[model samples]
Target: MLAVAATWSRLAAMEFDHVIIGGGSAGCVLAARLSEDPHVSVCLIEAGGGGDDIFIRAPALIPAMISGRPRINNYAFLTTPQPGLNGRRGFQPRGRALGGSSAINAMLYVRGHPRDYDEWADLGAEGWSWADVRPWFLQLEGNGRGGDDWHGGGGPVQISDQSAPRRISRAFVEACAEAQIPRNDDFNGPEQAGAGLFQVKQFRQGQRKGERCSAAAAYLFPALGRANLTVLTRTRAERVLIEAGRAAGVLVRRNGRRRKIAARGEVILSGGAFNSPQMLLLSGIGPEDELAAHGIAPVHVLPGVGQNLQDHLNYTILHRSRRRDVVGLNPRGLVRLGRAAGKWRKTGEGLFATPYAEAGAFVHSRPGLDRPDLQLHFVIGIEDDHMRRLHLADGYSCHVCALRPQSRGSVGLVSRNPADPPRIDPAFLSHPEDLATLMRGARIMERVLGAQALAPWRGGRLYPHDGSDAALAADIRARADSIYHPVGTCRMGRDEMAVVDPQLRVRGLQGLRVVDASVMPRVIGGNTGAPAMMIGERAAAMIAGAGGDGGAKAIP
Candidate 1:
């Protein structure tokens, strides 16, 4: 009886011209860009609270922030048991706030290799080639190093050099050079096959210094005062209210009440890979057999709604650092951090201002590969089990992950309940080639660690102390897990399994689109945040009746 009453209440409605579900990384960008035309009313819904928490703003607090209580801003999801990792369930930490995972991420501003976008174009995501999307990437960036042919100026998201990187990070880069990897200053430059320090998506000037420039901070917060834009936070969107095979509005739950907010223009799903596919499935738009099994009348039979799940599975090589100054957890390092915090509070320039994974490398597993197949994240602290285990001593770690995994999985509905979390099975390491590539990458990591530059600080190996390939492979199978890059659930392509087309419009559906990491045909070579934002920028241009020229251009 109560269910029927709630259903009736959910039917009570309001309307907007553009309703964007999920005020996340992509949603924030869409809302800001769409609301630029004041004539059009835009609504953005988020499942979490404001992104103004101090923990989220501080770059050094990312590790502590993600593990904090209330979990209002962090959807600390756990993956299903993977046969790859010896049946161990991996931890998936996705941000629930306005900025989404960008709020909780390491703030690395890696745009991935250009070949990654070229591959997307080849895979049927037309107009998304490296040349086509390069301008869009420039259009969204407000780089601190000024404008160039490859970068932009006066954009929203600020990409700045690390304010203060640890000496160990420098050593990691030098060590990579010693290991035969070239030192490339800019990973987003003409080439992406080397090692260097990473830039961050953070401000380097004015009042926003020493703070993260999340999507909420960069795009949504500034656009909040606009009358045409309505940002409803702490509200969960249940499902898209599709009427007569067309998306009409979204039914959302807030303050113990359900209301339908109609979309006159289009309903865009920006809820990411996990939530977006779940939303579509809940709306009866997934596999017909699965919907019937869950007692749902199918609205659209899209077999690939939650298919093609891909992620970068990484294994860490930990070593106790001989120097306390090189790591963050030791007593000496803690004192330095305490002093750095005071300096950051005053001048916004200190050790506390930089994300710890400051330096990394992208290398090919073999000689014939056109681009890098392996990526390395060198951290100045032990990050085993996602930092759940804290060692009292000084230590550093290197994480190696296969850039492109052939393994695929699925996200499915356990039941018809909208509040229930979806079953995420990222069948990590299902392919033999993926594990083999990771094993090869692990050997490269060992080589990097053994380089002359890192020898002074490197102590005894804390993980898999053995130096043989057989032992390393055993350790990889026991511990390899996700590095937080999950994508390709609602793949965009011309294939029959594709959920969305190249225009980001959902196939076999009208008045609907999906603009997020979920629409990625395949996972990119680097981080997903920058690419996800690029998708948002391009999606907004498409919706505004413009082609690919809607964003703030470079000032020539």
Candidate 2:
């Protein structure tokens, strides 16, 4: 295996010690960290192309990135009709290239609450409690505040506040304080509940010509100089090749051509939550009955392979200000765009900045809970007039989401072909508890909206404020959408629902690991980008024994 690795290193060709499935957040981090050792060959496969487009680099141009002709920034997918949402179909957007969702999502650098992973460790995913993962977070980040025991100074990923975009961002923080929520210094710090400007995964590309750097732009770019890394974009993994129930290789397709390659050591699936489980199910590793339906022999009848689907449920309150002044996205909105360009040219600081999701917080809706049951993610501007579809009028939206939902769904195969999208049912509002939390969440949204600070921006009731809990229950049923934080499916635990062990190895297959959000025992409390990136960092070190102290860090 070492000789082959050397041969491949010299030839700059196949046979990798680690084959990462997706070149998104997790895969990119793994590829960069693992390939640092030229002795080990690393292969990263991305179904999407490299993100060189200008829209991807700009923090404010995210929607335009997703709604373009090529749609190169995203892998657009539609879920099977969700029965819980009145059988309404939902849209699933996964990032296509180097940064994945980090490439397309509104750049919000939130690191959820510490209690989330602590609970995961308590639930069964050992060595994964907050204490174990926090170091990796600090390791990958070059925080704006510089290095502390909690953060690193010279990491590849650049994390800072939008330079000139701080005005509106500060306004967001002031409004949160005026509302009596008490400003919390850092969402990524000890406590998670409160409103403050969010940290962003942004960098000063240059005075004008630099591409706004992203995770892939940071982690993957530095590693590109290494000889051991071979990154193939637009090459999608068809299935994991299992030889006698042990992982051996993978089948991938590019430009209508199919090819096979062997993994001398391990085949790691970092395809996030949705595609990871879908690929596993397509490879005959899901429930026995589902595999039989597709006429494929079951490799392992893991009933939970695609089960336990969950995501943050969001409620948007749309308001039309009486001042006739557009908060965002109007003819006068060119000011925002103008600022982005001017700052991009002058100081690498402006609206091109990441004020997209500047202020946010976590809170327990009804109170008396052990932790915050809901998280508030407030954006000051209005991007799309409506939800999922185009808007009929001018308005700004404030979104509140139920953080830790009890509702569960599943992902399954639509057909035997891996090219086709798998059936995903996020099944939002499926449980009564989830419904109650979200309804209370709507009340919290109103409280924040009606605060004295918002008096200057207050308008008539925007979307729905008059509905009763029963009526709001129906309204929530009508329009509660996903903030796009999906997880579980390939859950990590010791129970039957667990598809991977605490070490993250596939239960029935040797040399195979699911090292992405798919293995999360449950979704974390905030945006998943940080947690997912941290997972990649830890997993790569574990696989290669390459980091500080070869021993796994213990959770506090």
Candidate 3:
């Protein structure tokens, strides 16, 4: 209950040209891009501790950074009851550090689908079509694939092929070929409708600890020397300060003490999808009735501030192998462990480098489908989606995800308290079209497993088939959920409910804007990380009044 304005005088000095809140993926990009000006002072505030851990930096060491595992690096936020999932409270694990989820995620670099952004432009987010966003994606990626019209060559983030491939990994790609699905050299390439290798964030040295080039390591670390940028770690933003009509500052807390940061140019909330809207609601910028119920007066009644929440719903299928498969334990983990240690100690090789999924593809459930409706990730371990954990059995698993569902959900405040988790109702299966598409994807998976080549290798179903369309549909509806990509809250549009305009500015507020996944009008057809970074990269150019070059050269 501290007064936000009362604490401003006791805190650190005056205004910054830009105050970027939540130094995660988008915030780090903004800080890096804007500070290139060397004139406009920028202040970046992150609630979590420094993202400086060896385990997080290593691409392979990422899975080891688990939450609720005592020393894991993440914030465990429980969701309000989800009415759609039989009143279940979902576990939303968000990173609490500089690079954000990019530091702790699986590091799979996916650009999603071109049509995904086309939907954005179609929804009145002008200049957000596939053509407009394609350049931004190219600007940030330094893939080993070399410079293409589609991808950049010498960008900060290194998108390269994984160092080592699991034995079964190569077979998965062959399996796709046997099933009539083509093999693609790149998922981010012109055609995204085939199975191939997925590009990852990796260094030439391979899975070395503390060397994973995350956004902070890639963009912000190099930009930190700029005198115009100030990075404040462990500072949690409580709410945005919208005085009269413009967003002037933010109410923040550090070391159990409160403070305020007033922004002269803009208070940009790059807190991503979950937090951007959550922060907005806490600052009395949401639906009229919701704000009034919390005893806070709404400054601008933006009904769509926390609406249009969307995420990919996926179900994994696991099968036992006929031979010493990817999941097949050598019966002596001690021997395998000894060999892996030997390899790493000698040639700097072994299982420590990669964990399958070295190859996969996005495919249509059937021919003539406009886009690839299913995305498959072939893991070496037996991962059961329904249980949300690895299986006890020794077998490899395949995660067949429904790329785009017709379902729509929402993320909104359950109470006035910012600490309280929001109610996330991603009403899956509520839409008939979503159910049909997912079922179709499931059938496609069945076809892949039923392929003649895989017939000899296929074992008993780990997720047993119910056989009935009604029953299979029920299993999918109950189990399939997010691939950790949640977006579109505080969606951008021209409608009355739109929270942000085409320029990513707040509809009714000045000096405040959101440049993150929260501005997506709909969930993209693929993973959202690449596109979210592009938004930050492109938005930086617009805000700086410079053309779309981040070359760090002097402005003409």
Please give the CA lDDT of all the candidate structures: 0.86, 0.74, 0.73
* TM per prediction: 0.95, 0.91, 0.90
lDDT of 1 by residue, 1-556 (tens): 0000112333334689889988778999999999999999988888877777877788888877565344646888888899888899888888888899999899999898988999999999989999989988999999999889989877999999988888889989999999999998999988998999999998788887978999889998888778777778778899998887789999989877888889887899999999999999999899998899899889888999999999999999988988876556767878888888899988888788878788999999999998999999988887777777778778888999998999999998888898888889999888999989998998898889999999889888876546677787788988778888999999898889999888788888888889999999989999999999999998898888787532221111
Clashes of 2: 1
Specify the poorest-scoring 10-residue window by lDDT in model 2: 1-10
RMSD each, Å: 5.2, 4.4, 5.1
Candidate scoring better on lDDT of 1 and 2: 1
**Model 2 over residues 1-556: C-alpha lDDT tens digits?**
0011122224445678888898888888889988988898888888877755667776667766654334657776777777767777776677887778888887677777787899999999888888888888988887878887767777777778656443434555666676667788677876778877777787744432224556687788667767778877778799999887777888988778777868988888989888998888878888999999989888877888889888987877766654433345565666656655776655666556554666776777876777677777666555432223544334456778888888998888889998888888888877878888887888877777777666665666545545677777777767767778989988888887788877778876778888888888888889998888888898888888764333222211
Candidate 3 minimal-lDDT segment of 10 residues = 1-10
Model 1, stretches more than 4 Å misplaced? 1-13, 68-72, 330-332, 548-556
Candidate 2 residue pairs in clash (backbone atoms < 3 Å): 340-352
**In model 3, where do residues sit more than 4 Å from their true spots?**
1-14, 66-71, 205-211, 322-349, 385-390, 452-458, 548-556
Q: Would you list the rank order by lDDT, best first?
A: 1, 2, 3
**Candidate 3, residue 317: CA error in Å?**
0.6
Q: Give the lowest summed-lDDT range of ten residues in model 1.
A: 1-10
